[model samples]
Structures are given as structure tokens and as C-alpha cells.
Target: MSEPSGDASGNDLRRSSALVGAGILLSRVAGLVRESATAAFLGTGIGAEALRAALRIPNLMQNLLGEGVLSASFIPAYSKLLAEGRREDAGRLAGAIAGLLLLVTSVLVVVGVVFAGPITRVITPGWPEGSARFELTVTLVRILTPGVGLLVLSAWCLGVLNSHRRFFLSYVAPVAWNAAIIVLLVSVGLSTSEQFTVAQAFAWGAVLGSALQFGVQLPGVLRLTRGLRLSTSLAVPGVRAVVSRFGQVVAGRGGVQLAAYVDVVVASLLAGGALAALGYAQVLYLLPISLFGMAIAAAELPTLSTLDHEDRRRVVERIDTGLGRVAFFVVPSTVAFVLVGDLVVATVYQRGNFSEDASVQVGAILAVYGLGLLASTSSRLLQSSLYGVGDTRTPAIYAVLRVVVSLLVGIAVMFPLDAVQATSQGISVVGDVAWQVAPEALRAADAPNALRLGGAGLAFGAAVGAWFEWLLLRTRVRIVFGPTRLGGPHARRIVLAALAAAVAALAARALVETIDLHATIEGLLALGLVGSVYVLVARAVGVPEARELTGRLERLVDRRAK
Candidate 1:
């Protein structure tokens, strides 16, 4: 139970992050495919919007009682007990938490199902009452609410597995979740004439998927924590501690969720497809955050929890390393989104009912989100570090502040943009440009205008809030652990590398525009070239991380040659 030495801890951190990242990558790829199938079947219309709203409405339960809160509270306390060699106490605490989460979520799920109509109405007041879309949303919410309860249990399993450093199985178990959706989409093809029918199919599939996700992780949790029993007692030694921390973390997560709900409410009032468009953009935006930010943060939290708070140097070192690794990957991802997001969107989703116009809409929102990629990812790591050190209140305070900033910024930007028509009249391009290939159905004069800028406004507001959160977290980390090694020269190098990659990508895009290549092919080529150029430039600028990455690639190549 002795704490890992500094070098051993760093190596373990990297290995754990790589494992989690690999698992997440597979799950995210499956998720992207699931989304593509959804778009192909439902399109970015009322059906899609209703489905998205239904999913988000019940997701409140999972967000409040699920991974974020559990990771913040349960993992820290459980890991601490293990570190102290209190195996029985840790197992009991896990069981107690599991029982408590099941009980609370069960009630919430039943109430949610019973009152699905009212909940859907409150969440999406813009939809006309008794309309097909509104009715569909209610039905879908009822189906999806039970899935939320299942996912809360899955998250508890995740908390236990993570505490024991069994990161891969818990993190990758979501493949079952995504795979189930894909199977449903493929089986129920787009031939279903009614959008509501399609939505219903997806809802049922999601419920099944949540069950599979939890089932896959249960054995691992049991193996890691033997003698685990289902106990509803909150009086257990470490259970009380976790519950105490859980409340603040839930408040923090609730603040974050409220900001999202605000976006949903505002977007609901804007246009028919506004919510759906926002959902599509968020899927693309979260890809890098999950792959890089969450991977690193999730790996480091358990290890960081074992660190003594008095060891300022070790705390600063671990946090700084996490931050740098996050920036190393996320910065390029941001540049990619800003420069070639349209091409990426077109490649991924512009087919069937998902029109070229939908790609443009999603891409524009994604570009705005790109502006805050670094900030958002950094804030995640910073929050994890705070949780590791048992300082949840600071983040909770800032989370509320972020919500206020997002709401204010969203209103200021969306209303004006909604009034202006978003047309692609002046921009002329050869080949498969987003505007040119848009379906006439999407461009019909009778189509809703609120769809044009409402999504963009939400993205902008989120970006603003994300940067504010990062700033607050950064300042707090500095005050608590001293200035990190990430800022001075290291930051400049990252910026320069990102700039070089952006230029390379832009140049590749320009070349593609002059020629007659498929947008997907052009996007892939551009991304590849940009990524290569970034690694080279980063290495030239003396970035140790970049150099280390290059070294790994070289060793792999040498092995292949051998």
C-alpha cells in the first residue's frame, strides 16, 4: 500500500492513460458510427430533434448521480481506503454506494417515466403540444429514462474498477452500448417511413445498450473487489465521506448540466432542427476531449489521490504533466476543427437525409467550439486534480459561474444571428463543397430560419464559458500548487506547432479546392499532412513530448523493418 515513487508514478500514469485512451478510441469510433446511422435514418429534422431532446431530458439523472460525481467522490475515497490497507472498509463502501445509487435512480426513473409528458414539455416548450414531434419525445423519454438508471449503475462499476486500476475494461465497456445502437440502426434501416417509428426503435435500442454496458463491467468490478455486498447503509466509515464529497460534486456537475439545459431550452425556441444540429456538432467536438483530456485525467486521478497534499512539488509535477499532455494533442485537434471542420463533417455525415447543408451547419458550430478546445480540456484536468486533492468546492463555485456566463453569452449572440439569413450565395468552389452539394429540400424558402445561427450561438456561449472555467481553474491550481512548468516556453512552442499545422492544412485545402477531389479524400489527406508537419515542427521547437512521440514512432518503424 506504499505510495508509488515519483518516476514509477509518472510511468504508471502514462501507461494507464494510453490504455484508457485506446479503449475510449474504440468506443468513440463506435459512437460515431452509431451517430452516422442515426443521421442516415432520422436526418437532422423534427425526428432527430425529438430524439436528442428525449435523451438529454432523462440524462439529467445520470449526470447528477453518474460518472462525474462518482469519480470525484467515490474513487478518491475508495482509493484512499485501499491505500490505507482497509480492504473490507473499501468493499463495503463500494457496495453501500452502489445500493444507494440504485435506490435513488430507481425512484427517479419511475417518476420520469410516469411524468415523461410534462418533463418533455418543460424541456422543449417550443414544440407544439400534442404534435407528433412532442408526442414522440414523450414516448422516447419514457423508454430512455430506465436506461439512465442502468447507466448510473454502470458508472458505479466504473468507479470501482478505476479505484483498483483496472481502467481498460471499465472504460471500453461502452463498446457494447454503441454497438447495440448500431445494430438497431442497421436492422431498422431508413426504409421506415415514419420518423417517430425510427426514433422509437432507437430509444429501445439505447435501453438495451445501457443494460449491456453495465453487464459487461459487473464481473470486472466483482473480481476487483471481492466480498462486495449490496448494502444500503450510509453509516459505513468511508461511505459517509464519499457522500459528503458527492454532494458538492453533484452540485458542480448539476451546474454544468444546467448550462447545457439552458442551451437546449433556448435552442428549442429557435428553430425546428436547432437542437439536432447542436447535438451533431457536440458529437464531433467531444471526440478529442474524450480521447485526450478525459483519458489523462481519468488515469491520473487515482494516482493523484494517493499523493499527500503537503507534497506540493509532487502535486504540481503530476498536474503539470497531465496539462501538457492534454495540450500536446488537443491543440492540433482545435486547429483541425477550425480549418477543415467542414470537410470532416461532410466526410462523416453528409449522406442520405443528412444533407450538405447539415454538414455546413454542424461544421460552423464545431468551428466555434474549436476555439475553446484547449480551455475546456484543460479545465477537465484541472477539475480532476482538484478532486484528487479533496478540494471540490472551488470547482463547484466556478461551475455555477460558468453557467451564468454561458446563458448570458448565448442570448446575446443567438438572437441577432437568428434574424440574419445564413446563405452560401457568394462563396463559389469547385468539387464537393458543402454549400453546393446541399439538398434543395434543406434550402427551401419555407424552411425555418432559426436553424441558421441558433446552433452557432450555443457553441459560442459554450466556448466563452469553457475559457472562463479554465482561467479560474488555472489560477486556483497556481495558488495551491505554485506555477506549472507548462506556461513560459512550452506554451509558445505548442502555439507555434499548432500554427504550422494550421497553415499546412489550409494549404492542402486550397490545393484540393483547385482540383476535383472528393471532400472526404481531401479532408483525410489534409489532416494527415497537417499532423505530420505538426510533429516535425514541434520536435524542431524542442518539445519533449513531441520528441518522445517521434522516438516511439521510429522504434516502431525499426521493429517493422526488422
Candidate 2:
């Protein structure tokens, strides 16, 4: 096998990380804007709920089968072949995978379109009785389902580019996605409601967004590869291996999708914008994890794959060393959401059709989700490690474990705490949420009540599931590195750093509250001051790692300034 020269290997990792990071960053911003716009146009209404629910089908499928899993399984194999000097064969593998994806996704999209109503019935049966919400959802799914194909193609392109250590263009595709959606939202707003329903416009935007995701990367892909020819031959050598790996990737990824499906089922029982609340909450929770945790995961993958057996030890060590930094970045962000969740919801979404009540409700969900952010972020990195090692099944196993625990926890917790009823005790503004996502709607509508009966079941499920995931990670780490060598001063330093960050975050929260800066300009100013104070405290509290990060950041700024 031909090994990548030192310079070439280093350059490859850097370029891919930068590109994927850039694309993810852009996509995250655009996604926030899309969520904001959707909230504005539809609010927490039946329309919003239906739209969010419908959108999930395509998105869930995409996430489950497209990005992480597809890339995880495909990239390693592709990279291995290339490293062995099998360029033409690698290219052929890419084309074969792409052709297979095209065929499979094409079939799925058609099925989705034809059976949209039945799918909706299965997924969100209680979508507001006697309302056209159900019908509209069906319509929207049909319009958006084709996106599955485009996105699958985009994923293939991204994986191919990542294999080549080219990442920038792929990352920017999301910028295009958001821009397209923003345009659609603006256009719809400018026109009369009679002209086009927001649901229809958003669906069209989805199709356009997926196209943009594919289109933005075309030039890059074309430059990297000669051309793609659809291979009809099933006897393609690498095709079976890639497809089988993809299946493992899909199973591993399926847990997250299943978790999402559970949310939908729960929200369906809850009725009246429950889906929107959960959707909004999930996105808000995902932001920091995406920003920070993903930065490390994205950077680590290609490097991990190329590491020699001995150097692979460093791969695990790098992950451990980076976890502190990841926590330092992510913990505070999660806290910020927890502390100012209501203000955030109010600020970004509480206008137009989204009322103060809706903001409060979503805020509550966001707060609970905050507790699990660290677990979620760490899980992603852990899975990335598994991918790097070409062991898709381990992560798949962990995912299944997580889902089972989540479901069990959800069931166990819902029966005892009935936390929904409990949330109403003090927060009148969000009291409706307890009522909204309740089992009553299901019983009243004669729908299955498993979701509501399973209430707090989902939340507890997440908590328990996250624990199992964390355990899975520890076991893996132990196997990689002996148990005797694990958990000492290094772990202590990280905990202390997290403690410092937590304390700083709490102080920031208090200052923001004291200045009454939560609702207006004063709040923004206070938030800035609090963030500054946290940095200072983090530095003083022996958070040298965090301090180093800030130092590196300032050096970059200084260089830019010069």
C-alpha cells in the first residue's frame, strides 16, 4: 500500500476539517434562520406542527442513511483503496455506491410520495381532528420527499470530497440551503396568505435547498473526479462491502431517528403544536453540540483512519485530551440556553404567529434538553471513533442500547412523576405544554395513547439512554486503553474545569437576571458582560485548557489585526 507522505496526510486532514467545519457552520446558521422563519410564519399552530412533522420524515431518513453513516462506511473504504494506489478502483467504487444510492433512494421517495397519508397516520395520527392539517402534511411530504434523493447524492459527494481531504465547498452547501429557505419565507410573507400557504412554500424550499446542497459541491466534485457513470452491474466488487457497511451505519444512526420518531409520537398525542415545541427544543439543544463537539469530531475522523496501529493510541488519547476542550465550549452554551431559554425563544420566535405562550413552552423543553447536551455531544465523538476504526457495529449496538433505555425510562418516569402535570404548578405560561402533550388528546380523539401514557417516558428515556451510551463509551475506552490506566488526575482536571465553567455560567445567569437584561437591550449587554466574566473566571479557576483555547483564539485575532 502506498502511504500518504507526511505533508500530504497533514494537508488532507486540515483541508477536510476546514471544509466540513465551514459547511457545518454555515448550515447551522441557515438552519437557525429557517427555524426562526418557520416559527414566524406558522407559529406553534397546527400548520407549524404538521410542517415540522412532515419535514422530519425526509430529514430523519437523510440523517439515518445519508451523512454520518454513509460517510462513515464509505470514506474509510475509499480512503483505504486510495492509500493502496487503487485510484481507478476507488473511483469505480464511488460511482457504484452513488448509482446504488440513486436507485434505493429513488424507490424510497416514490413510496413516500404514494403513501404519504398512511405514513402520516402512522407517525402523527392525532394531527388535529377535522382540520386539513393531516391533508396538508401529506401534500408537503410528497413535495419534500424527493429531497431524500438529492440529499443522498449530496452525501455521496461530501464523502468523496472528504476522502480527498477537500471539505470547504461541502460545508458551504448548507449556507445555500438556508438562503433558499430564507428567500422562500420572505417571498411568502410578502405575498397574501391566499396566494400560497406557508406549508407549501416551505416544502418547495426544501426541494430547492436539497438541490442547492448538491449544486454547491458540483464544481469541487467535478474537479476531484473525472466523471460518474451509473453501474448497473451488481457484480461490482466493492459494492457489496460498501452497502453492507452502510447498513450497519444506518442501524447505528437509526437510534437517533427512532428517538425523533418517539418525539413525534409523543407530540402527536399532545396535539396543538407539540411537534413544533419538540422540534424547536431539539434544534436549540443541537446548536452548541453542532458548533463545538462537531468541530472535534470533524477534525478527528480522517486523521484517525490514517493512523498506524501504534499511533492509533494517540487517536484515543487525542479524543480524551480534546474532551475537556469540548466540554469547556459546550457546557457553557448549554447553560446559556437553559438560563435564557425563554428570552431566546421570545426574542427569536415570539413575534408574528408565535405567541409568548409558545415561547415559554418551547423554552421549558429546551431547558430539560440542556441536561443531556454533554452526553449527546460525547456520543457523537465516540461514534466517530468507531467509524474511524471501521467498526460501525459497535456504535450501532450502543445506539440500540440507548433507545431501549430511553423507552424504558420514558415509560417508568411518566407513570410516577407525571411531570407534565407538575410543570403547571408554577409556570402558568408554559402550563399548557403539560396539557398539550398529554395523553388526553389521544383518548379524546380515540387514537392510541401509548405516547402520552409513555409521557416523561421520552425524557426519562433520553436520560437513561444517555447513561447507557456513556457506559458504552467507557467500556470502549477501557478496551482500547487498560482500565487501570483510565480515570485519574486527567479526569480530575477536566471535572475541575467543568466546575469552573459551571460556576461562571451560574454567575453569568445571576448577573443577567439582576440587571433585568433578559428582555431588552440591558439583557444583551448583561449577557456580554457575563460571558466576559466567565472567561476571566475560567482562566482563574485553573481552567488552563480553556485559557489556552482563548489564547489561541486571541492570537488568531492578533494575527488578523496585524
Candidate 3:
């Protein structure tokens, strides 16, 4: 047997996961910069919501057909072909899938552009028809739809690359997309104060960036698929299997996308800043998931699929360590977000049009999102295990359930909180958010002065849904595979370490806030303290990942000293 290729070793799993993590880290940092520039230019104003809402509608095309579907369907099937040493079959499969994806995405692009107005209305249910923001969102959607077509093809590239274990190029390709937006936003922001004009420019930049993202990965996909045959033939070897699995996974991903659409719709119904603020908070919330959860899960899927039926015991061992590794890092992230999220959010976005209060409100939403951080991260790996075993419909069923629960809970809680609007006192003009006020704002003397914390309720609803998904996923995995509980020794140590770190960090945050330290400096100091404390406590409690991290740092330091 080779290590994951044959020996079935967990070390191979860890190394592959590290590669995925590094790629995601680079891409996420770029995305963060793009979001920061966006915050500075748009703030939580109407322009921000318009851009965010516009992206939401067209992005549905990508969301349903994107990486998740490929991961669930294509990777497992395509990877199995390679594992059997059928390179020609694998190449043909990849080409056929790519051709089909291109055709489907082309159709989506046309549908989205032609029906942009109706789609915009459906996506932002709370926005009145024919409003200026609605019209702006419609225009932006037309511009962004082609980009979605490009991004879908990018996802095809991702599937092929990930199956080949060429993880970095596919994962890092998104940097191009983020970089393009950041460049355009900064350039336009420097030259103008008109939000609508900036929004229009951003749409074009995003489309170009999406093209660049796909273009960057094309060479890699082409290189690996040397015998590639681009065709939409359903009869290609393994193509039917891929298509069958793709349908099931799309069903699962579709349910998840439905929940997200509900989130946008519900937020549109809230007071002015709900959608925009939640968008900012989500950038932070999704970072850890992308870095740790997704990286580890994605790395494991191909290997897990290869090992399916041949070595159940070895596969379960891999799952245990992957879950614990994800838990070790994610626990602290959850702690930091819940305890010091305001500090982080302020440091990242409290400049230009983004006010201090808006950052704090976004922080609160991050904290709410933090409540289910562990469960959400854990669910990814669990789902991959299910996918590895060829059970897609179960996840699809539960995904629908999760969305239903999320919408019901979110709707019940969001409207009341929306009554109290949130806005910055520094802004003399009400800006463009006037059209977004909740009904109760009409009776309030100081409606704009209210804390726009309604987004937290929505976040809380999402957190609950996350945990529900995790619990269901865990139960299914246990029944199908073996014991997949995350209550391993390392997870317990991670929890304790996170708690101790949070306590000290809270003290650090309070002391730093007492002084007049700059927001960025204060955040760095506080977050640095949290990271240091968490690692040290985890080391003392004998978490092996902590020891591994310490050893790696020591090795790097020793080498640099030379």
C-alpha cells in the first residue's frame, strides 16, 4: 500500500491539507483586501446593498453548479478512474464534464441577462420594484451574469485540478478575481464619491476578474488533461456516473443556495443596513471555514473516494484526525470572533465611509455566527465522508431541512429587530438607505439612531441551521461508516485552550480599549495575544497539533537564524 496513494497513511492527508490551506490563505487574504476596499468605497449604504444584492442573483448560477457539485460528483468519479490507472478514461471524462459545464453556464448567462429584472426582484424580495437601487441591481446583474458563466467554468477547472492533486493553482486562482476588484475599487474610489458610478465600474471589473480567474487555471487544467477530449457526449466513459452524481449534489447544493437566497431576501426586508453589514461580517465568518474546514475536507475527498470499500478502517482513521485538526484551529477562531470580533472588524474596515458603529454591528453578527463555527466546520468533513461513500441524496435531504429551519427562525426574529434602524451619526445626509427603513421606523423619533443589530438575529438563525446540519451529518456518517464523533482528545484540549485564551484576550481587549491605541494596533495586539495564549495553552494541555505548530515555528526560526 502507498501512503494515501498506497500505504493509506494520514501523513499524506495532512500534507495535502496543508497545501490546500496555503492556497486558501492566499486567496482569502486577497478577498479580504477586496472587501476592505469595498467597505471603504460603499460602506453599508444603498450602493453596498445594490452591489451585494446584484452579485447574489447571478451567483446562484455559480452556487448551484459550482465547486460543491463538482466536488461531490465529478471528483469522486474522475478520481476513481485515475486511481485505477485509466488516464485516458479520466481525460475523456474531464473533457466531457467541462464541455457540458460550458454549455450549461452559457445558457445560464443568457437567462440571467435577459430576465435580470425579474431575477433581481425575486432575489431582493423586500426591495420595491422600479426603485433606483432595484434598477441599479438589475443593471449590475446583467454585467455580472457573464462572469458567473466564467466562474462556473472555473469550478470545472477546480474539479479537474483537485482530482489531479494540483491543489494550489486551482485554489489560488480566485486571487485574480479578488485582485481585479480591489484594483478597480481603489482606483475608482480615489477619483469619485458617487456610489452609483462606482458600483457600475465594479461590475465591469468583476467580470474581467472572473475571466482572468478562469484563464489563469486553464493552462493547468490543459496541462494535466493531456489527452483531453472536449465533448458534451453523455456516452463518454464515466460521464453518465458523473452526471448522475452531479444531479444529486446539485440538489444538495441547491438547498444550501436556497437558504442563502432566503438570507438576502429576509435582510432586504430589514432596516437599511442589514444586507450590507451582514455581507461584511460574512467575509470574516467564512474565512476560517474556507481555510481550515474546506481545505481539509477538499484534500481528503479524492483520497477518501479512492480508499472507499478497500480500507474502511484506514478511512475512518483519516476522518478522525481531519476532524480533530479542523477543531483545533477552528475552536480558537470561534473564540476570537465571539470575544474580540469588534476589534477585528474595526481594524479591517473602520475607514472612509465605514463608521465605527457599523464595524461594531458587523462584529456582533460575527459573534452570532461564531456560535456554530465548530459545528459548521465539522460538517464539511463529514459531508465529504458521505460523498466519498457515494451517498449524496441524504445530504440533499438534510440541506433542505436546514434551510427550512433557517428561514422560519430568521423570519420570526428579524422583523422585530428591524424596527430599530441602524445608521452613523456622523453622516449628515441619510444617504440612500431611506428606502430600506422598516415599517416601525415611521413612528420612531430617532429611528436612524437605533442599533442595526437585526443582522445578528439572522446570523443566529444561520448558526442554528449550521449545527442542525452538523448533527444530522454526524448521525448519518456514524450509521454508514464508523464512529465519527469529534469528541476526540484533541477537540477537548482545543476547547479548553480556546476558553483560556478567550479570557486573557478579553482582558487584553479591555486594557487596550482603555488606552487610545489606534484601532488597527489594538486589534493586532489583542489578536496576537489570543493566538499566542491559545497555542501555549494547547501545548501545555498536550494537543499534538499545538506541538506540531510550535515545532514548525522553531524550525523556521532556527533556519532563519543561520
Ranking by TM-score: 3, 1, 2
As a TM-score, model 1 comes out at 0.94
Q: Model 3 Cα displacement at 166 (Å)?
A: 0.9
Q: State the lDDT at 25 in candidate 2.
A: 77
How big is the RMSD of model 3? 3.6
Clashing pairs in 3: 1-6, 1-7, 2-6, 2-7, 3-7
Q: In candidate 1, where is summed lDDT lowest over 10 consecutive residues?
A: 429-438
List the candidates' TM-scores in order: 0.94, 0.86, 0.94
lDDT leaderboard ranking: 3, 1, 2
List model 1 lDDT by residue over 525-548, tens digit each. Answer: 878878899989999999877998
Best by lDDT: 3
For candidate 2, the lDDT comes to 0.66
The C-alpha lDDT values of all candidates are 0.82, 0.66, 0.83
List ranges where model 1 is wrong by over 4 Å.
Answer: 1-5, 421-451, 485-489
Query: Which consecutive 10 residues in model 3 have the weakest lDDT in total?
Result: 442-451
The superposed Cα distance between candidate 1 and the true structure at residue 170, in angstroms, equals 1.1
**Model 2 Cα lDDT, one tens digit per residue, 36-62:** 878777776656767887888777667
